[model samples]
Target: MIRKLCIGGIGGVLCLLWGPSGFGLEPFAPRGELRIVDTSPLNWLSIALNVFERLIEIDIDGNLDPGLATGWRWIDDRTLEVTLRQSVVFHNGEAFDAETVRLNWEAYAGLRQPQMMGEFMNFKPGSRLEVVDPSTVRFRFPEPDGAALVKLGRLHMANRQFHEEHGWGEQQWGMLNKAGPWGTGPYRLMDGFSSSQKRSDRIVLEASRQYWAAKQSPRPQRLVFDNTLSRQEALQSINTAEGPVDLVSELRPVEAMSVAQSSFAEQATKRAALVTVFGQLNMRKAGSPWRDVRLRQAINLAVNRQELLGDIKGHGVIIPALAPEGAFGYDAAVTPYPFDPDKARQILQEAGYPDALMLELIAPEELQTQAISISMMLEQVGFTVDLQVLDAGAFQRQTRLKDVDHPPEQRTWDVALRSALDHLNFPPFLLYHDFALDGPSDWVGEEPELRRLYEEILRTVDREQQERLIRQMERHAHEQASFLYLYNPAQLYAVNKAVTFVLHATTLLPLVETSVTDAHWSVRKISGQEGASETRSAQADWNNAEQVALGEKVYVSFCAGCHGANLEGQPDWQKRLPLGNFPAPPHDETGHTWHHPDQWLFDIVKDGGQRFAPPRYRSAMPAYRDMLTDEEIWAVLAFIKSRWPSSIRAEQARVDARGQ
Candidate 1:
């Protein structure tokens, strides 16, 4: 049967930019702009995903909810039926139906580009989305996937009519506006917001008037995004009172604190984020020393997790596995490796490395401080460690195994620090992708046990049985010292208190539920209750002895690497060397840090000293915004200040008084 569904477009409606008015902001005609950081899809997928919609939408809590596909049900172990939502229209006046699903799934699968969305979702090969009726579709898979529903939650649907007409490209959406590919999402990309334009610094998204859902939060007249703006530049724009900026997207901890302390932003709020930071040891490469299970265990035992992750400001729970706490496969009983240098040494010696084992440690530029600390720890346990720090892009390419054409030497290091997970709920997916015998990263055909266990979990249909199987796999991997687990950093945002914004677990800003005047009123009503608790916590004296001890703990975890354990920084700290950057300076009296005020030091620690410096200035000191909390920052500062002589502290106290 041939079916032709036509969706009509609504007539033109005026767009009002909702700028901030007084406290009791009454909505006048739209006048303000929403400035967001749309840098890269990899770093900003949360925003891009919100800009588009899938058949089944995964909510902020990571549960499947109704989207283009109204609901779905498993027909059997390998077949599923999905009911589509009718009367939904794409931006191009195309009515959505079951064929829309089929066309989009096919096109997405055929796309030659390496999109983060595609890799993250892990679309099944040979699976087809077939039309059952005008409003229903069915999916037939070769094998039963434990995360089939989760995969469906990631299958974003697009208008077939639009894509066929315009053709495909990396920036197809950006190139064509209403005439190009479109989704039934809440926001529509405004025309002429392309990169080719002379003033193409921004990507504007106006609210969709043709949206089917009822309005919950008062809709923004228009949501303007500036993709070109850096974090530093965005903050500068928000600081201007009469500026067109109404909202500022993701801010680092230091930047948020800076905005809160200054007259620019009203308040900064923190939320728990769903991100993990860990180290992956490549068991595949035969040339790597970590091939021995005993050696891997020794390396894991040598790590002082407390000194590595403790005192981090907003870092949430520190665990042994990448899975979040209470997640399906996370086994709380399986403890993290303790800091035992002696045991590590004994294990290394027993593993046939009596004198010392040599290794290369790979890490991103952001994790240089961590790499340095890890190197020292391994050295203490009688391992000769050489740390290699690469920029984000280079680091990814060097560590990635290119399959048959890519040789062992190209795989670089034995161990590397990385922050990721393929599926948040399924540990088996991560294990399969990174370490299974035939996996890309697994250069050597090792870990038959992990492969066997992961395959078993994939075949298991029962949820309870799946979780139990996952737990068993995680334990086995831990016992083999497969991967060293680390802490999950908390997600945070700094916003103008005028706008009501909620940061979700996925860290995407809730644009649909956000309103300027409405958010202001809401904040005012809840301030008294939430404010009292905040006030009490903020009142803790950082100069006290207890606070100093707290700071010492924080400094050991984060600062001791570059700044030296005794607070005496790197050699030639003041010299601007080959990289056009100075080495990390001492925090003691001998250093110039005491010459500055408390707030000055705080800014340096939170945002990095290079942030406020010249435009292209570089620094090895990574921002501790999401990693460490404000209190922890103060504790670190207090610890540094305590080490200074009384004269230096008194001089800094006078310097701090000038700001008051």
Candidate 2:
């Protein structure tokens, strides 16, 4: 859309002004130089992997493709038709159609995305798409689909004249610090990274070459997002300060063995890992009604997945995954909340609220591991629990105000969330429709038979009759307790292999299936450019950039008051407001802290994000264990990898491989 691909490095300061007291890595893609990191950012409308496109993208391994509707049909069962794909385009060059998919489903069923992406809009957004002209399009659907390609694979086209010329409602599009590079895919965007103002902390995509469905991953001549907050401070501001993660999604197999004891420990690669950090339980928080289902199955048996495996390291952080563990029609004989508190105090007196029932719980105090282990397993069950901890912009303005009745200690926190539907594509549309309550409160779970078995698994592409109707809606969401299908989590990234990707697994995150040949290859030319790569070379990039500038002076003492002063978070994170509850999580690399694992990122910077989210509890995250130190939790994980992605310093030397 705005082409420019020279790629010749501005005379690399005369090669660092004649050097040897020297430092290295100077490729910066095809050339105009683009230091990567953004370990996150690019929420790109629910997830098609930030560079954008939808009408089916899927990946991580689930695979799917087509994005932007290249082909579709039906004309009946209520009509489908689709078509569009005439050399797709968007980053503003405009030109993709059906009135930009009916003005992005009339701005995703309007009310201006009140609680974000209109409950991740699984299509039918005020239904329509019609056009039947400019590259066709028809979709009708008053009903009777048989699940038209999983509801046109939860349709997504966007750019309806650029969200009606950027009027973006859903609370000014969840207060973005940046994003409008808009999709056509393959990649676009060039001038934005903290240009000092005009609100751009970072952004720089490249690879389009008139993209329509370009493949073989080859795109990267540049990508830099930089946004940063802490995946070890974006790998200590790109070691010597460069960026764009090669791999590093959410580390945790014992923090990938302290990056395999640093010095890029041969880019730690015990089987090239990726994806999984699981947790979710929006049980539709009917204000504070202890989410009834017998106090949500007595807070899922006061959880103790082996007390989070001595604080997370990888391989089955407790096994159990009632559903989400690797999500895909899941069904291991289900167990909504096993581990019993004497049947969780006999289901808290069969829901009559027995022995003591006072509740209040909210999380994301920046995920101190599910808000300090479910606030200590909801204070070991008997109830009377209270832990609010807001910050991600007042917990996304109290989950877009799904106030749900209120009362039990004046509402606002009852069952709490953990949902990890992980950008679902029919895992009961994020397992049991966000944990049902009744209907229309965004995030999900108002259950009209889990939204009619998510419209009977979207009328049916018949993947075994949509896995026998999503195993009868995950066994009616575990006999109507709604959600707690925990332990399907695992997404611990920590690569230092310099860069490579086909990075399979699918809860989203593929980086257009990454790759690289010369940003200075060696490590035997990156194990001969990929014949089984993972490769590394770091040696602790200058002691992780001086312990991430001494963990940004303890991240300006207690993380710039709820993650900001350049972390660009909170403010309205996603808008849960009124009194607040869950939105603030954008510590650059978008979030999940470079996916996590320097011992759960040094116990969440010495224990805070409500100490790894716990027992449906409260938190605004504070616990730096009497204020930081394990070398100040590896210098705030080297200031969260100085904000991530120079192939995550070669995915930290090919997953800390340290020769094997």
User: Mind sharing the TM-score for model 1?
Assistant: 0.65
Every candidate's lDDT: 0.62, 0.50
Q: After superposition, how far is residue 295 of candidate 1 from its true place, in Å?
A: 1.9
RMSD in angstroms, all models? 22.8, 24.7
Residue 358, model 1: Cα distance from true site in angstroms: 2.9
Candidate 1 per-residue lDDT, tens place, 102-147, comes to: 8877766676532332253444677777788999999888887666
